[model samples]
Target: MSMMVNSPLYPDDVDILAGALYAWCAERSIKLQSQEGLFAANVAISLYDAGYHTQDQLLGALHNYEFH
Candidate 1:
């Protein structure tokens, strides 16, 4: 599956990363629930905490998701 960054859903302070991740998941028809979102959120947070905010950075840093 291919991964790409997306725009923020809500306001500027909302979970921009989650929104991007969700968009990526949707593009691949990958369903994500609270649990899945949490996992991705964790990964997103990790990348953000590391001072990385690009979609490529997030996709590069995460490796546990099964994309079809």
Candidate 2:
């Protein structure tokens, strides 16, 4: 398993991060439950706290998610 720091969903700013995560969840057709949204929000906050600062940085973390 990869660490969260290595996860591609990490975001630079809170809004964009949330947008990316929201879109990801939406693509999966995940229902926007309060609990789930809260969890995603927390993850975004943690990523921000960890010093991620660009879309490329976040995308690099997401490398594992890419389809070959």
Candidate number with greatest lDDT? 1
User: Among all windows of ten consecutive residues in candidate 1, which has the lowest summed lDDT?
Assistant: 1-10
Candidate 1 wrongly placed segments (more than 4 Å): 1-16, 27-29, 64-68
Tens-digit lDDT track for model 2 on 1-68? 22254445433365666656666557556564766655554554455446655545543333334322
* Tens-digit lDDT track of model 1 for 1-68: 11333443344424556656777567656666655665666566656556556666665555444522
Candidate 2 weakest lDDT stretch, 10 residues: 59-68
Q: Judged by lDDT against the true structure, how good is candidate 1?
A: 0.56
User: How do all models score by TM-score?
Assistant: 0.47, 0.47
TM for candidate 1 is 0.47
Per-candidate RMSD, Å: 8.3, 7.2
Q: List ranges where model 2 is wrong by over 4 Å.
A: 1-12, 59-68
The count of residue-pair clashes in candidate 2 stands at 2
